[model samples]
Target: MNNVKSLNKWANAHTYLPVDVLRMALGVFLFMKGVYFVSNIQYLVDLISPIEKIGGGMFLLHYIAPAHLVGGILIFFGLLTRWAIIAQLPILICAIIINFMGFMHHQNLLLALLSLGVCVFFLIYGSGKNSADYFFKMEQ
Candidate 1:
């Protein structure tokens, strides 16, 4: 379809090596952060308590770790990168909200803001030429 061609063109257009490097870096950062969350379950639980009070509950708390883990891996490999980023958005947004509410440390707010910015960038530009998305798209 013409639309698919258009999308592929747009996705491949104007990609730079730096962008891909940054994307991979973001992926690593997210993956490590996710691992941190899993390793520090008590800390994660405590951090999400306020969010839990805001109707997120135990379910939200419990799922956040694995979502980050899986999403990070997907992003890292550039496999289904957009979907991975989309999946992480809800948790990231919620974190931003919670952090801004003065319930978290100032440094946490900064980290959340930075993470949100990078995620938004990748969401819009996708994975670039160095990614699995690019390889698959090329094969198509």
Candidate 2:
């Protein structure tokens, strides 16, 4: 916990505008993906259909869109960013697995990997100085 606090302090001190913008872009991408998933529910269902025998596949199905939606908003606003990204990580991991289960869609795999990478980055770097998390902490 002490190490985590020190890392966070270092990350916050080193943040830059470009990094914040990157975070915003990642958030937007996730939000748009959520919207896409919501609009094309059938596609997502079909994608995960093969995994239905796994017991909790359907349950996981219900989590994806909402996680992306809520998590994206939280990440975009830089509020509880690590928590939001943590929520997204599992979904992204499943996405990667699903992409390979049936058909190897290189594009989808690439996108998932990229998103996962960004999420991992934010998970460590935090919301930075321009984030709502920082703002609220400062107020307190």
lDDT of 1 by residue, 37-125 (tens): 88988888877777665685778767788888888888888888878988888888888887766476888878878888999887877
Q: What is the lDDT of residue 79 in candidate 1?
A: 86
Q: List the residue pairs that clash in candidate 2.
A: none
lDDT for 67 in candidate 2 is: 91
lDDT of each: 0.80, 0.90
Candidate 1 residue runs with Cα over 4 Å from true position:
1-8
Instruction: Kindly provide the TM-score of model 2 when superposed on the true structure, using C-alpha atoms.
Output: 0.95
TM-score of every model versus the real structure: 0.88, 0.95
CA-RMSD of model 2: 1.1
